[model samples]
Target: MDMKKYEVGESILFDIGQKILEAHWQDLLANTSLRFEKVLDVVTVHQQKQGIQNVRPKNLAPKAQQAYFQTGAGQTQHLITDFFTDSTKIYQQLKALDSILVRNLGPEQIIWPFSNRPQDLLADEPSVPPNEAAQLGVRLVLSDELLTQLFTTETAKQYPSFAAFKNAIYLHLAQNIISNLDILVYFFGAAPIAMPEASGVKRSAIQAKRFLNCNMFQDFDSYLLSLRKAASEPQPKLLQAPLFLRPQKGDLDYRQGVQYLDLQVLDIQPNVADGVFDYQVQFLKLFLLFNVVHTTDPEKLTTAAQRFYQVANEDPTQPSQARPRVTAYLQEMREFATKFFPKTDYQTALDKMTQVVANETQAPTAQLALEFAQSGLFQFGQQLAAKNQRILTGEPYQLRGYTDKSLEIQQFIGSAIELGLNYRFLDGTGEFLQLRSQQQSAIINARITAKNPLILQAILADQQAMNNLLGFAQVAVPKGFVATDLTVAKSLFHAEFEKSGVVIAPQNGPKTAQQVFTTPIDEHTFTTSFLEALDYDDTVVVKAFIPGSVYDFYILDQRILAILEQVPVNVVGDGQSDIESLIDQKNDDDRRGRLGQRPLVTIPKTAATAAFLAQHQQNYQTIPDRGEQVFLSAIADLAAGGDSFDVYEEVDQSYQKLVLRIAQTLNMQQGHVAMIIPNIYAPYQPQPNSAIVTDVAAAVSIIPYSFPFAGNQRKLSQVIIQSLFSNSAKERADD
Candidate 1:
């Protein structure tokens, strides 16, 4: 085959676009330029250094006007138990946990006072220096000489800098790590406590104590009041601080208590890879009231949560195959739960897990293999499901091909121990398949596991893959087949020997598989195109099942294009208006905030602004160059640090016809001009009350700006004005 093809977005290595236009090698290669991705090892990132301040001993706090409860309004015993309060209880729980995964933490692991900090004590030495100072510190703790010292003994115990280095690394990883999602366990070495739930050192601790008296009826109101007060304050507090001592204000702020878990992937095909996987683990501690017997309270819960967190936070190896560390973590979990919360029992949980395995139901198509020995779904799949036998009646197919011992589904999930056996199939497994095409002999690992096999999804994907292999194309269909990757698909999408789904489909005639996507365009063509694609002598998957927001990423391109199509117009005003007073006098409103009466942005009253310059010209009292056009855009709800107005911008035409086309395509308001008032800082954005009208697209959204300076950036003063649609232009301005 002498054809060439290119993956969307990937630049062709050679001049294929021209070659394609010339029809070079289009027949032989079928335009399949053997597209392949060079698999990259995970990228490792170093975290920025940040300071940590944990004012210890719990007794510190400013006095409050009202009495606060510290021992907790009696239920403190049932939940997050802190063993440190009870020596005997602490020892007992520790002994129990030791049975599962014995830990050898030393004094260094404990919370040391400020006076003992190493940076304040030891001379400068690199992390892995070999000397008596290092040896003494090394043997004093659990690590061998090979393990680099995270912090010196003096540093580990003393103030200010003791755990600062470790906490900084942990924070760095937490902020940046985006592991492949295959890794189940992530560990961070020497994680210091994330900040508490409060702020203003004294008040934070005060807030922590008040948390105890919270209950159902009075509970929610109390939290709301406290949050309001917390927000009134300015500085950000750390997340790791226990709320009982000091509360970190924002649970949503991800930067606090960020930690890195370094790990290596085992069972990779190649011997060596380019990158090191940097991982992160979040210890989001929530404070809740749990009713418990005084004998079985929170002190135990707190202790267990900490210990469980600690074990899980142990540093990881490069490709942890044996994962003694991970097992140790599981063991820690069992030990912690069984020791204090013995009623929850270890065996009971393990036994219940086996139920997850036992519930596996056979695939419905297994009957096909039973009836026609040599053919299973393969017969129908090869015929593109045109055969009537492939049609389903009331009884669903019990897919049976994934569990064949010959194929060994265990290989994918062994590290995580997600040995799926149960029967959540209906609510699970999007689709199932064991496609065996000769096109690419390379075998890939399953990364998305299913609670039940995703039989339908797999069949669709396999069908599409086979079709693509056959050189048939699937035209773009709106809201078409997009894949929702479930962890079960990656972990337990397996095949076994007993009733294996791994059988290779026999050679069939050439077929094509195509995937389609769409935006907010007229649904008429999209609907027809989708159904036609579905029945195109191949297979179709309506894009519903694919989860998350991956669909949004695709249509953003259309969004940009839609913006470009709007009719361009400039801002202008009434013929008779003073340029100076016009800047301030433009019809406008101001809102009250934490600060009194702030105009959302530079709402132009003057005429000198360029928008004013272009629109009025010398005729409108010599186009006052002082201000800009203002849209009735609400200033502070969601975007630009505001909320979604929920009010769709009014569609207008006339002077803003261009705005209408762009807005309609983007589903935005056609005429509302979202203006910008640049703060002239690092990053810039539209001023308050100045968002360009958008549509349902903005409804499904994420925060557009997150960097530090997002708030202070200046707004854009000039912007495009356009009509929303074809006919509405003249009718708008007359109103």
Candidate 2:
């Protein structure tokens, strides 16, 4: 990157771009003898052609830049093939790192192209926040007014459509990207920089680091308002769960002053990783081992633990002959347990299990170990002192436990063993997609944990085997949930297994179909997408296309339009009603009996919090914070985790007819459902696992789009489900 002289109205902050490149790039080429000047010229040429016309070209010479890139697609290359043999592995690793960031926040979260002028911002101590609330160091840098101005009627008229206009405006603003928030994170956030000619670096989240799009927790004020509301409400509704909303704070210096087009930056401290990405890409059962990863000579730890258990159980004497490995494994297990929950009594759970295996020559020691690993109970029971330390980085999320479902997981394992289909979770999606490194994390309530003990043996194998071992679909392991299944998986699949699972057609339907009808401005026709088009707050029009076979399910009597919204009873308002009164009123009237929040059984610091809100202009009788509204308009079938009621029937026949017509317009097919989300039911509901930044340690559930692959969550069924469903699938004789 060349140091460019700015225009009369321009400024250049810190050369963060260079620093970013140094950290993520320099190492790969430091020892190489090749020159990178031509590569630099190409990059410079494109950069200038695109938008950066003001940059100085001298820094990007023909010689200094070619050390890494291979420019001119069809031109012959000089880079040696000797080092490229493991390029796939290297590429996969980089992708893994990128996936980690995206899984936590999002693919769009890392547009941190940053540049601070003359002074460095991160170097400052106790980073000054833009808001009065110092706790949540984040804020809204851009106003809704700006978006409106960019994509208003005038721009839409000129462009012929709103979507096209939006894209054009976004591009225009991005072309001239400049924000302190962007610069700040670009320098300090752990985003890797691009290597001049390295296409691989740009494969994942890290690649977009150069865009400088500013996806930080800039929407702090909104998040703060949401959090405070969550606190004031009786049931801190799941709608306002830590994930969907940003945390609250008290400092107030944040204002992206109207400098370049009055572009202001908001600032506030966050309680969580507001831009958290890639937490639930895969699910896995976890097992933590205290002893050596590999079995040792003399006797395995299980043998030792078995002897200890037998002595402790029977003789309580003559303990010298006990297996030492078992005792060691048990000690480590105890230490792990102590980390989360300390108990001075009965310190032999691990030891006893191992000892039982050791004393009985025919005992299934390996199978037992595999069981704990798959069930992940050991990981669950123990807590992490530091949330970032990962013992298992890439393991499959599967059913494991002492239940029927476990039998399924085990059966799956056994089938895998017999068929030898190379299976893994954190490896890659197209191949061993089920077992890739991106989703593996040994964290709390993880769908997939840090390590797959069953994989320990497989992973420790040679690299050739690891690379060739791809994932398969034409197979089902009914015993995937089995506790004592240790069938070594092979590299093949059964033909019948491939065709047995349910087939869900990818869902697709009408968008906000824009039709210029005369009634859009006058009649207020629900048949047109215009009702949803002009939506101002707390509303959404979910368009689903169900086949006729499922038609009755939609029109069920128990089906009320379930308004899954952020708890609206947030502000009772005025001075007449107390919080209890408001809570009672809301509970009595709302279809949902108890709010979708943890019960007020223990309000923690309820009184103090109320007093604090009173200090803010909010009255104790009235609600304060109002989080942005998000509603899930689903049928209230109870079984679908919704309440009961049928209010849709009360609407005028004309309205009902229009609703059905609108559904038809959106390709409703023969089966149409009635779960309408009127402005009345709109509430600011936050989605699950929204606490990306804050509650990294908490075991929050995963939402559909929020998770990596679609079916990545089914691996968490209880033990009984695993044992019965997983291990029982009939095996075919492909042998």
Give the per-residue lDDT digits (tens) of candidate 2, residues 562-583.
1122120132333456554444
Give, for candidate 2, the lowest lDDT window spanning 10 residues.
280-289
lDDT per model vs. reference: 0.22, 0.23
Clashes of 1: 141
RMSD of each: 33.5, 34.4
Alpha-carbon TM-score of each model against the true structure: 0.17, 0.19
TM-score of candidate 2 relative to the true fold: 0.19
The residue-level lDDT of candidate 2 at 528 comes to 30
